[model samples]
Each structure stands twice: as structure tokens, then as C-alpha cells.
Target: MAAPSRNTCGTRERSILDRVPPLLTDLYQFTMAYAYWRAGRHQDSAVFELFFRENPFCGSFSLFAGLNDCLTFLRSFHFTDEDVVFLRSVLPPATDPAFFQFLRGLDCSGVTLHSVPEGTVVFAREPLMEVAGPLAVVQLLETSLLCLVNYASLVCSNAARFRLACGPRRKLLEMGLRRAQGPDGGLTASRYSYIGGFDLTSNVQAGLLFGVPVAGTMAHSYVTSFTSLEEVWPRTLVTVNQDHDPVDLISLTKGWLGRVCELLGAEPGKIHEGELAAFLSYAIAYPQNFLPVIDSYSVTCSGLLNFCAVALALCELGYRPMGVRLDSGDLCKQSVDVRGVLRLCSEHFSISAFDSLIIVGTNNISEQTMVELNTKENEIDVFGVGTHLVTCTKQPSLGCVYKLVEARGRPRMKISEDPEKSTVPGRKAVYRLVDADGHPFLDLLCLALESPPEAGRPLSCHPLGGGSTSLSVTPAQVICLRQEMFTKGQVTQPLSSAAETKAQVQDSLQSLHPRHKRLQEPDSYTVALSETLHTLVTDLRRASTNKSNVVLAN
Candidate 1:
């Protein structure tokens, strides 16, 4: 079969879509595209905005993501000849031939778009992106945008949960690749995980793709490959002593660690006199046991006790093996008991063993369970968040929907019995209110050309009123919310790096009022309609309902 010809997005400079996301959307988008053409709505100008009604993972806040993916989707969007031919083969026998003729001329030429800055903090109900163009073009974007946002947001929310639980020591790693849906699923999950606060990932391709730090340790397979667990050390030591070994390795390893003391200009004898001395010596001799596997099968207290003996021996020999790996049972209890054992042994030997014993947990670390374990004093360090983190088990989808907000100098709204589902009517913009401190407090939605009062002034605009301030903003300063992201089809802003995005999420969360951060029954952020929008919605409602009433009265 011949490859389909690509659709050209009407722009002078190429977009990221020129490389990826071209094939990401489902087949139905094309079928819908054909229908729009047949109905003569293909070139009829329209607009749609993307936003979600709630945050995921039951968290107090959410991180904004997937704008890059959205832009890439838009830029790469095109009807390939193969795509067209497939549509031709699938069209019903009775379908109009003229519709297919129109499909042949399809291109994203008449579309105009707008969006929020990617790293900005957002809330429920507000539009993140506005797509205005032909109806067909707007319809085509729905599936792809939601696909990107849903997954990205899920991982971001998950990462935030971990960040909150981890406290000051935020050493997190993404160990979810193998269980992720596909290769890219793992890759993107790691990307957003870092944006949500993880330190690194174990997926090598993901690390290279998004510049995330990749981390891994020897699997049990390495140990099983050797004759015995004892021989595992000598072989590992040989590799550690290879020609490419770092000088730091010499100081940190057993054979040459005495040299580490000398290089640091300290007496080797004195350095070995402390509790950590024995562990350091063993590390130099047998670095393979760094974070040695303990509960490979059963995670019972007896299992931990057996490993505790080996850990004590390594500590006595001056090598603090990395940490104890827990693979099975009652982690909260076992970790506490293991720490107590190490402490007793260190005291008996008159050595510092507390720092030498690190408890690492793998297998079952989802957001909910991690929070539960984090609350305990016996909780383990270094969680391997695999299936749950990668799969986004709690809220697997973002539910990001795009709808038209305005066109040709007129406001519009989507009406629904559910007020929360009701679209904020008009050509509108979102404003974030900040206080005297450079922290965000509330988000205010208003007409694109409207401005609210200054800080300390009465915030008198009803979020849903027309030309009247029904509910004044309760005593907070107003920070202008909207930012210029694109002009015409050209990008006006630079993309935020993963590091910057994570920092933004952290800072934004700190700035939020305590109520917004509550995991349970989080106080909803104040979202009010600008008076104009409220009035417009009210009028539309009255007109539609009144028309029905008139018919009934007749």
C-alpha cells in the first residue's frame, strides 16, 4: 500500500507535529471530517476551548500539561492520501460523492487558535485552549487533545501526591516502565513524573528522550547468575576496579578506600575507628551488595531479621551496603523492626549504624497507599512506584474537552442543566488574583477586554453577573490572568523545561490557600462568571426555556 500524503498546516515555519503526533488521533476524526464537509460546515468558522471540571487523584490542585502535545498534534494534522483512500473504501454506498470531493481539498487553512501558558496553574471550568476555525477542523482536534491532556495530567497529579508525602527529602524515581501500556506510555509518564517532582526514572529511552536522569541497580538476575551470593561481590569488585573506574570509586571501594582517606588528607586508621568505618571497608570490597535484596520472596519479620544479620556484618566490615530491598509483606512493621535491630547492633559495636541501614520498598506503592505508608514512622525510603504511577490507576483519563468560546466579535456559550458543565459564556479570559506577597490566591474569569479592581480594592464583578458585581472578590488583590502565547499561527512564547514546570507546580501549590490544598473535601477555588458572561448565559437560558414555555402555553 502507498503511504498517505501529509496534510499541510497553513504556517510558514513547521511545528513539532511535522515530526510526531500525526498518527495519534483515532480514525473517527477523519469520518467526522468527511461528514462536516458533506454538511457544508467544513469551512464554517467555529471555536472550542479545552478544560476539565475537576482535578485528578483526589488532590487539592492540578498541574497544567500537554500543550506541547496539543501544538504538535495541530501542526502535524493532515489528511494523507492513504487516509483519504481508507475513508473512500469505508464510505457507505449511498453517501454523497460531492462530500469526498470536498474532503480532497481539506486542510487546516482557516483555523485560528489560542492557549494558556503551559506551566501556569489552572482550575476547573476555565478553558486552557481555544480552537477557532472551520467546524471540521475544530472537531478533528477533540480526540487528540484529550488523549494528550488526560494522560499527562494523570501522571502530574500522581507525582504531586508523592511530593507532598515525601516532605523535604524528595528523592523519587520512576520504576513504572515495564507495566506501562506501551513504550511511549512509560516514556511520557516519566516525563510528567519529573514535572510532578520525581528525581529520576529507570526507563533508558525515556531518560534520553526528555533528558531525565536515568537510574537502575543490579536485578536479582545478576545475583542468580553467579555461583553464590558471596561470589557476587568479588565479580562486582572486578568491574568496579575496571580501567574506566572513577577516582571517587577508589576512595569509596574496599581495596583503595584507605587511599580515599589519604586523598581527603585524613588518617585512614582514624577514619576506620568509627561505626561507619566497617561499612566503608565492605563497600570498597563488595559494592555489589549496595541496597542488597532481603525479602525476595517473603516479607515477614523473620525474613528481615535474616537480612539484618548480613547488614550488620557489612557494617562491621566498614561497607554500608546501599540499603535493604523489601519485596514482600507488612512493610510498615518490618522497616521499624529492622531499624531497631540495626540500632542495637551499632550500639553493641559502638558504631553509627542508624545511617548505614536504609529501608527501600518496591511492588505496591500507589498514591493512596504511599500516603498511608508515609504517615508511619517505620515507612521505607526509595519507593519503586511502578504499575500504579505508570498506569495512573485512580483517574486514568483527563476528560479535557474543547469547545468554542467566541467568533466574529460575538460571545457564545454551551448550555447544560448541570451548571458546572455550563460553559462560561463569551469571548473570555482568565485572571489569576495575587496578594501583596507574590503568591496566587484565586482565579477570576472575565470578558477578554475587561479588567478587575486593583489589590485592596473591592472585587465587585459577579463571576456570573452582567454589568454588576454581585459577589465581590473577598479582600484579595487581582493579578491579570491571561498571557500572550500565540499570534495568528506563530508561537510567541518559549516552552517551559521539565525542571521549570516542576518548580512552577511546587511554588503554585505553596501559594494556594490552605483550603485549596486539603486532600479531603478541598475547598473549591472561587470561580465566578464575569457579569457580561453571566448575563449572556441568563439570556440564553431565558430565551430557550421561554420559547418552550410559549409553545406549551399555546
Candidate 2:
């Protein structure tokens, strides 16, 4: 656990942004950069906002993630010599050699990023990060910025949604690595899911890279690997006892096995011996962290009985078994049944620890399923989430678009046949208005030049205001969401670690109203434009349509 080192560029030594290079963008981006250069607009100053049209999973809120990586990318954004050579070869022979020189010299030294703190709860049509720089350089950044933010925000939002469904009492384990799209996707899911409130991850690499706690258990494959007791040769183990002797743990475990079967109404001869032996081997290997998948044979018939036997034996050796995982069947009923059995064993055997053995529910557990589970009584303590959390099957992608909003200090708008597709023009500043109770009541976006909102005053017309309704609330605190992150080829803002970001998410969630984060029929959080910005939009629309009475909002 050494302190992180910083390079001359001010980026951390081991960062996610190091994995991304300047060339990891679409060909159209390069083409557009070249066109901007060809038209003599390469250095024309432009402002672009990175935002999403809607929250993924139909949820009302999303956590702004991946900002750290974006800043790191800016810190090290320069084309390698090889990249410039390849671009020269790809372009037509008539292409100016000066373009390649420009490419080779390209870096984001002049770029400035203004963004909300990472892990802030964001809404639709609100800017998460704003980039201001030369049009060519900013255009070169569009694809990579969106690529880094979209899925990170989407999966983090998904994980937060699942957390809401499960309640705060249950522990969440990210087990989606095996079911993710690829290695990178899996690793991303692990990192963001933990930041989104997951307690642990099964990806060892994520643990190593992101400082996420890692854990695992014996899978069904391991349970079925043995067919007889003889397979478990050298069946002795050293315990915490100071006797310094290898006790025959297998023999001791077998003694308790018969007792467990008799109490659970299973014939010892008919019980799954291979499964029992596998459990013992796993226990011997990781006595302190033994949590086996107990549904491999039969939860109550053999799996539970064998696990209880091995667990009691471990207790005798002064080792505590972690618990068991329920991977199949009616999870609700089985979880309740398992808890009852544990209660009985704890009371009968005078081993009070058995009463609190963790019961983890797995196997296709969805958000809806969790909602149903919460309605009934169950003893499941942890959720081992897989495909749904990582793959984002409910809503796979977040449409975070990087769009030009202003150029050459003049505000611009993109009016469209679809209002949702239309762009909000200008360099905007974002604010969160908090009430006396410290809950943020609304989010306001205004032109950066307009006076910032005050603690007490009449706020102006809504950006979404097509009608006469206006917000006139006096806030206890008018908090600015924007902070300078990058300038002069360095990250100017202090960055937060994964643990710090996750704590921010927790705090932000608390500050948010519960209605906006509910599992079903969530209340929409307000994101409005200031009076000046609204007036500007109004004039822009009127001029575009040559009509006086038209409004700017849907």
C-alpha cells in the first residue's frame, strides 16, 4: 500500500486513462478534424457538452462516473509518431504534409474541462462534462469521451438501481465477470459497480487494479468433481489449535454428517458423498473463507446437511465458515427454510454463530425479482449478481452524446423536428438548489455569463417552461456543480479514489429524495434553464421559425 506516484504530466501512474490512446477514436473524427483544418477553422474556439438524453433502465437518475478517467486521458492526450505516420498513409496523397505535423504535435494543452463531481446524481439533458478548446482538437475527443463515459455511467446507474431494489441491509457481490462482454467490459463493470455501492467483486484483477474486495466460493463444477470419499486423499488439516498436529478433519466431518442427515431426514448412505467430499476439500483449502454452493445436489436433502456438518466441524477446529450460496430453486422459500434450519442447529448444538451464517441468493436475480423478495420475509443476506449487473440486459447502453453548443464565443442551437433531439445552446453553468433539510430540490442550468443564482431570490423561468409556471423557491444553498478539471496539459483538480467516489455516491443518494429513486414509477427530478438562457432559446426559436408565438421546449 504505497502512495500513488504522479508523472510529469500530472496523471496518476496507474490509471484507467493510460489504457486509452488518442487514436482510439472514430475515423470520422479524424476526417472532421482534417476538414476543420482544411476550412481554416482548426483553432476556432468551441464549447462542447457531454450529456445524455435519458437515464438508462427508465430510472429517473444516474450517477456521473468516469470523469477521473476522462481527466487522465486529457493529461496524456498526444498522438504517437507511429499514429501520425499511419494517418498520413490512410489519407489521400493530396493531403497536406502539414496535417501530419499538426497531428504529431497535437496535445490537449489548451483544453479545459468543467464538470460536476464524479458520482453526482445526474438527470437527462444535463451536462456532465463541458470541454472548451480548439474545434479540431475537441472534435478529435468526441468519440473517446462518449465511449469512456456512457457505459461507465450506465452500469453504475444500473448497479445503483439494483442497490435501491435490494435495500441497504444486504451486501452486494459483483459476480458478473464471467458473463460480461469481454475482459475490459468485465473489469469496468467491477470497478463502477463497486463505486455504485457493491460491497465486493469476484474479479481478481478488479481487486488488484481498483482496490475492490474480492471473494469466491466453490462452484457446482467443483462440487461434482468428486464421486467418492477416496478421491479426497490426505484428508487431514492443521487447525488454529496450538497442539501442532494434523487432525483427521475428514473423519471428524463424517461423524457430524450422520447426525445432520438424521436431523434433516436424509439417509446417510444415499447422500451425495462426492459433494460432501468436495465441500470438505474446499473447507480444508480455505477454512476461514469457506462458503460453498449448497444447491448443487439438494438444498435441504444433502447440500445443506453436508455444509452444516462441515461447518460444525470447522467450529470445533476454531475456524468459522463464511456461509453457503443458494444458486437455484425457489430462492425466497429456500432462503427462509435455510434460515430456520440454521436457527434450529444453533439452538440445538449450542453454537450460536450458526444462527447468523450468511445466506447468499444467486441465479438470475433481477431487480424485479428483488422487489418481489423484499415484499416477503427472507433471510438472504447477500446478492451475488452476475449477467444482469454486468451485461446491462435491462438497458445495455447510455446515450451520452458529445455535442457542440457554442463556437467563437457565440451561442449556437440545433433546432430539430424532434424537441428531444434539439440541442441547448451556450456555455452553461449547473447548480443544485438545496432546501433547509439539505435535500437538493432542483437542478438549474444557465448561460455561464448570466449572474449565478443566489441563496434567496426569485429563480427565473424554467428552461422547460413552455407555459406560465415558474420556479420561485428560495434555497438554503445554491451549490455550483462545475469545477475546473483540466488545463495546460495537467489535471488541475484533485481526483478522488474509488472508495472516496463510492462514499460520495452514498452521500448523494441520501441527499436525493426517495421518490426520484424508487423502483417503479419514479418521480422525475427537475432540470431547468435560467431566465436568461430560456429567453435566449426563445429568441433563437422565433428567429429560426420566423414565428413569434412558438416556445423552445417540448
Candidate 3:
């Protein structure tokens, strides 16, 4: 294949700062934008916050992600000529020409955006993002913003759980491609995995689109294509290995190479168990020299011992076979004893095999077992995560919803029997209370300018030494959760690159406590009632509940 072009100069230098969103937004958003313009409420300043009432994956805290993407989407949001033309074609006969003309030049110019820079340990009801602008502008943004944030946050949180299980030592491969909901489903999962701390991904498209690292190895097809071990070794060495890796083990006898080869349906050789032991005795003699695959037979009883034989053979041959593989059977048990027998076999040959052999466990690994296996920290070196990792079959969605909180200077609320599902009234902002260490303790919601009582409350108190926790304000003491990302229907900020966005997510994961990162019952991040909002909630609750009671009483 020809190498991809490296054009130093190309088509028009793209406007990275003023990116526009695709025109295929939810129809309601456009209709609302048009209505606001028609009603002269297009420039009325308003505020709305984006938040969730429950954590995805049942975790206590969620790592913020997708802000970069959100910003990019905002910057690129506008109705193009093509969009206008298409609208003209699709509008009903009752549609007015003036409305279509207004939309022809329409773009996001009146909105101001603020967000809790992606990667904060946020909780339910804490505004992750805020959009204040003309009523129509804010309303139009609802669907797309929710669509981007909800799914990104969900996958980011799930990836964090996987990170907890693997820790810093184990490398992770995000294999969730085939099972993702749609193209964006898999695409977003790759982006989220990077933020949640995965090392690489198998999706080449995802890697290119998101700037994530890509990696893979020989699949089973390569193993089945060759006739003998000798042929396979010579072919691989000549085609892919020799120039890249030139070492002593690179030179081998054809006979020994043939003995090393084991293919599917190949007959077993006549070596006795003791002869097998003798061959492996010679195997571990060289270090960092060779690697052999051993899962062609029973991976437990005979597989473990056969691995020992290979190790011994390499030792006597003045080389160490790099590792063994377990492709079948209860991996949990095999992982435990493989370490034991490999140790015992190496010692018997007097080869001092500490850290000499690596064990690769592959096939059928799921999120559940991967979590459990990783916690144990055995001698397992790498995981060949295939089908399960690539296909995120369970909980493959982020149920993000967006509703109009206010319009035309009037407060609004969606009455729902499920209190947890109720929307708050009016425009608001979310603030966090910080401890002495400058870490956020809890998030409090309040009217845009109303300060909550706990904002300056001392976390801990002392009368004398000044060491007692006093309400201290540092330039770094409080982080403004929102920033201006758009204005006057135009994107004002530079679009976040995939790398920048991914880094933003990784940085956010650091602030969370360890227990709050688990996949099971995660420790909850605090979302609390502010004094004013608390009262408002109380009053609203009583009024609504009383109205229902009055109806019942009648």
C-alpha cells in the first residue's frame, strides 16, 4: 500500500477556533431557536446547568469527559447555506419564508458557556456545564449537549473502574468496537477509555479519530497458516523479525525449531515426560532470548508441566524462553499453579527462574473477571483481551436527558411523580465547598449570584494557633466550574484536540478517592442542598405535595 500523503500545504486552512456542528440536530432545537427569534426573545439572557441525578455504573464519583468535544461542537454550530437550502426543501406549506430567512444566517452568537473543566470528581445534581444566553439559544443546545456529555461520562466512569482493577502496572486494551451501539457508541468508548486510563485500543478508526494509541499482535489465523514450526519461525524471522530483532536466539537449528512448533491437529512427538523435562532444562539457559506458545493441549495438568519442559530446554540451550500462554480452562486456577510449577521446574533444573518467564493469559476475559483477576496481582504479564473487551454489550448506554428549565424570564419545572426525576426551577449555578487541603468536599446548588452559607464556613475550627481550620480563600482555593465557550451564536474558544481532551480526562481522575472509583458500590461524591436552594426545594415540595393532598381531600 502507498504511504498516506504528508501534504505540507493543502485545501483551505480550516478554522479550528470557529468549528461548526453538523446541521442534523434534533428538529425541536431549531424550531425553538426559530420561535425565540420570531418572538423577539432571542437575545434575552438566561442560564441553564447540565447535570445528572444519578451516577452511571453505580459509582460514587464520575470523571468528567467530553468537554473538549462539547466545546468543539459549540464552536462549529451554525446553519450553513446547504442547511438553509435543505430546510427550504423540507418545510411544510404553512412554514413562513421570513422564519427560513432568519435561520439561513442563524448561528450560536448569544450563549456563554461554563463547565467544570473535564475530569473533576462530580456527583449527581452538580452542574457539569452551564449555558447562559438567549432563551432560544440555550434551548437549542439542550439535546446535543446531553447527547455528547451523557455517553462520554458513562464510558469514562466505566473505564475508571477497569483502571482500578488493573492499577498502573497492567496495560489495558479497549476492545469495545463490534458491540458499541452505533458508530459513535464505539467511537466515544475509545475516547472515554483514554481518559479513564487505558493504554491502547484495537480500533484503527477510533485511534485516528481520537488520537489514541493503537496496538495488536498475531491472531490465530497466522498460527494456522504454517505447516511446521521450522517453516513458521523462518517465515516470521525473514518477513517480520530478523532485521527488527537480531539476537542469539534468532539463530536456531531447523530440527529444534520443528520440535518447538505445535499446530492445531498436529500429532504429538515421542518425547517421554522425562525427555520433555530434559528439553526444558536446556531451554532456560538463555535470558531474554526466546518465547514459545504452549496452549495447544490441556492448559492445566499437562500444559503446566509442558511449559516447564520448554523452560528447561531453553535453559540447557543457553537461552530463556520468554513466556508461556494459557488459552483455555479455568484461568484463575491455572494462573495460580502455572506460577508454582514454572517456579518448581526452573528450580529443579537449577536455573534460578525468578522473573525469567512471563505468563500471558488470554481468551474469553470479561469485565467481571478482568476486575477480579487484576486485583490478585499474580505473575500474569499481559491480557489478550478480545471479543469481550471490543464488544461493550452490557450497560452500553448513557441515559442523558435535557429539559427546558426556564424560558422568557419565567421559571419552569417538569412535574414528575418520581422526585428524583424532577427538574429544578429557574437559572442556577453549582459551587463546591473545599476542605483545608483545597480539595472539594461537596457541591452546592444556588441561584446564579446567591452565595450559600457553607461557602465560607470553616471546615474545622481552633481558637488559638491559627492552625485551626478557618475559612481560607486562596487564588487556588476555589475553581470556577464554568468558562465562556461561546457568545453571540459564535464559538469563541479553540476546539479541543483529541490529545488535549484525553489528557483533560486523565487529570480529572486523580482527584477522586480510591474507593469511589470501584465498579461495584462506589463511594458517593457529595451533592448537597444550599441554604437558598434548599428552602426553595422545601417550599416547592410542600406546595406540590399539598396541591395533590387538596385534590385527594376534595
Candidate 4:
């Protein structure tokens, strides 16, 4: 790939950003910007922090994602001529054209962004991203930034849970293309799911766009297409010997059917005709990658037996049968039973290929289902997870909020009646503290100017509540979590590929304590404030309270 232009305002970036209108923001953001402009506070320096208050799906951590997309939006943040015209039409009849001119000239050239890297495991209340610039310009970014990060992080976290359930060895495939929220949502899910440790996706468009590996098998409709064995039997069969005549196809088919009937204790003519035809046709079409959906009619009684017959025939003709898919019934028990049948067929036919056939389970599997299947003895080699992974039905949103934290060098915060809704004030820096065993014990948030915690030093940290917790650090390391993403509207870091980001997630998860990664009732990872930041927050709250009291007394 070519390096980005030094000018930072590339035609490619502008073209990509052109697709996103300036009016994509909420109407309230425009109103606020107008108010600031009227008061001559539009150009005043300000800071905003984007963070979530709680983990989605009741999990302990969230996978930070969509930083690349957010940077793209920032780089391409200009209002088009059409946008200004539309704004004029929407404004009141007596509105000034100077406001439209302001909109026309608006861009993000003065903004600086700092963010945790994509694929980082972040906790609630920690800043995922921070924007520092003019108050009006920064305010305009709130809606778009939240829209990009919220869904991406939610889907990525959900995929991480699924990855945990599948373990390290089992293959996990994203089969959610048909069930995703929309076309763009499907592509986004595939891209982030790869970063969250999925092996492949079934969406080919995503594969083309994001370089994610694409995979899929024939649907059940392919089976129903061949209504009878007569449509596929003799025509699709191939002779084992190259010198043998094509006329021997019928005899070969009959010989395989006889063996299958004898092993299954069924009459040759009474076998499942349509399923057998489909398997034969599909095998003939894709002999090297034949994985027939076996539960179209019956798994054990008919589908399994018919597949074994077709597979044995293919083996005799020098082709390796790939696998079988069980898409219905109790997948755990059905997989065990199907494996037994394959083993029995291998012994009966004296063929070793039957014993090694892959079994895939794909019937609406969820994270809990994967956990349950992991506990039981089963023969499934891969999981084709779909709706549950893409839709994130358990928790569809990751409540990420972008709030103003500082303005004109003064720390600011939003006080709320609910304590959880209260904002963390200031230009903050986040550091991950690793203990002697190399596990991250806690995350420390401090004023950006305050000195970072040093190694081999005992530090006192305070949680959101009033209590202070002390950690004795004899062999620990403190590492900064946030990096400079954008400076003066230019991206500072090269975008990471999906494979690289996936590896980062895997490595980060390895260093995280297992207690914090549990699916249910996970232990909360400590996110604390440094002494200076804690003191500043307390002082601000006290001052705000006194001012409110004075107003009421007056």
C-alpha cells in the first residue's frame, strides 16, 4: 500500500467522506453550534471524552473498535455546497446568510484526537477517545463518533464472547450475512468479527472489501432441487477405473446403494431419494469440497446413511469427501450419533475415510450454547454461528456517550441526579498497571499533565466511591493505554489490518485475568482515579453544589 500523502487532504479521503453528509448529526448539535456562534464562543478551545458507563451484555470488558472509521470522518469533515443550501432552506425565513457561510467553511483542521487503539480491551468509564478543538467543531462530532463506535464495539465484544465460548482449537465461522441488521451492518459485523477472533465469514462482499476470508456451503434449497435420485444417479456417477466404460455408472451406483441398505437395514428403494440425489449432484459438482447439509430430512435414519453411501462411492472414485452439516435437532447428541454411524460405516466398508469426516453444527447456536456444548462430549469440528452473533439480541447497543470534559483550559463535568450518569472531568491520561505475574490489575486515570505512575512504587488509588485502595508494586510496570490518533486533522498511525488487530485481541485477552473474562457474573476490573484527579473532581462537585445553593437562596 502507498503511504498517505503528506498534505493530509487527499482526494481519496474526501471522496470517502463525501458519502457522509454534514447533516448526519442530530438537530440539537446544530442548534447548540448556532447558539455558541451567536454568543461568540464558537472558536473557544474545548475537550470532549467518548466513553461508555457500563459494559454491554453484562460482561466485564469491551473491545474497542471503529477508530479507523472515526478518523476517516474527521479527515473528511467538510460541509458540501449542497449541505449549505439545504441548511438555508431549513432555517427560519429571516435567518442570516452568514450562518450558512459559517457552515460552508466549517471543517476539523484544528482538532486533535487521542484514543485507545482498536482491539484494546477497555472498561467502563475509561475514555475510548478524546477530541480537543473549537467548541462548535467538537460538538458537531458527537453524534457521528458515537454512531460509529457504539455498534462496532458492541458487535466486536459480542464476537469476543463467542470466541471465548468456542475455545482455541474449534473453528468459528460467521454465517450471519442473511440475518444481519443491514448491508452495511453485515459488512461491519464481518470485519469486526474477524478482529474479535472469528475464522471466516459467509459474506463475500465483506471479504472483498475488508479482506476477511469468505466461506459458505450449499443451502438446503440445493437439496430440494433434485426431487428424485433418478435425476442424478447414473449421470453424475463416475467410474473408478479410467479405462472402464461410462456404461458401468449404473452398476457402480447400484453396488453402493446395496452396501448402504445392508448396513442401515433398509430396503434399497425405500431410502431418502431426494436427499441422496442432492448429495450425489453436489458431490459431482464440488468433489474436492463436498460438505452436504445432512439434516434436510432426517439426520440419523436417512440423511446420515445416504451421505455415507455417496461418500463411499466418491472415495472409490479417488475423491475425498469433505464433511457433513447438521442444521437441526439436538446438535450435541446428533453429532455423537452421526459420528457413530460414520464409524460403523467405515468398519463395514473397510474404508478409513469415513472415520475422519468433519462434522459442522449450525442451528442457531448462541454463546451459551457453545459453552454447554463444550462441557459435553461431541464430535462437531466447527460451529457456524449466525443471528445471535450479528444481531447481539441480548444487548443490542453499547451505550457509548461523547461528553464535553473541558473548555478553555478549565475542567468541566456534567452533574446528574444518578451517580452513574455523572461525567469524569478533565484532560485525562489512562495507564494499565501490570502486576508481577504480567496480568493487568487495574487501569489508572489521571490529569494529562500529572506524572504517570512509576514502576516499583507503591501507589494509592481511589475508586469512584470514597474509599482508597493501595497496591504494593515491587515488580510492576505502568503502560499508557491511549495513543495519539489524529493531530491537526491528520491520522498519526497506520491502520491495522484485520488479521493484525485479531492477533492483538488474542494477546490482550491472554494477559487479562480469567476472572474478568467470565461470561456471567464477571469480576469487575479496577478503574481508579489518581490523587490529583480525585481531588479535582471533589472540588468541582463542591463548588457546583455551593453555587446551586446560593442561587436557590437568592
lDDT of each: 0.63, 0.86, 0.58, 0.84
Score residue 380 of candidate 3 by CA lDDT.
72
Q: Which stretch of 10 consecutive residues in model 3 shows the poorest summed lDDT?
A: 4-13
- As a TM-score, model 1 comes out at 0.78
lDDT of 2: 0.86
Taking the tens digit of each residue's C-alpha lDDT, what string does model 2 give over 263-359?
A: 7777776678899889988888888898999988888878888899999999888888888899998888999999888888888788877977899
Lowest lDDT block of 10, candidate 4 = 1-10
Q: What is the full ranking by lDDT, best candidate first?
A: 2, 4, 1, 3
Candidate 1: deviation at residue 437, Å?
A: 5.0
Q: After superposition, how far is residue 70 of candidate 3 from its true place, in Å?
A: 1.3
Could you report the Cα RMSD, in angstroms, for every candidate shown?
8.4, 3.3, 8.0, 3.4
lDDT of 4 by residue, 291-394 (tens): 99988887766788788877887888877888899898899899998898889888988889888899999999999889999999999998999999999988
Stronger candidate by TM-score (1 vs 4): 4
Q: What are the clash counts of all predictions, listed in order?
A: 35, 1, 48, 0
Q: Which is the leading candidate under TM-score? A: 2
Residue 63, candidate 4: how far off, in angstroms? Answer: 0.7
Query: How much is the lDDT of residue 333 in candidate 1?
Result: 86
User: Which portions of model 4 miss their true places by more than 4 Å?
Assistant: 1-19, 233-251, 267-269, 466-475
Evaluation by lDDT, superior candidate among 2 and 3: 2
Candidate 1 residue-wise lDDT, 276-332, digit = tens = 332323444555565555554343322343344445444444445566766567778
Candidate 1: minimum summed lDDT over ten consecutive residues — where? 1-10
**Is 1 or 3 the stronger prediction by TM-score?**
1
- Candidate 2 residues lying further than 4 Å off, grouped into runs, are 1-18, 463-469, 546-554
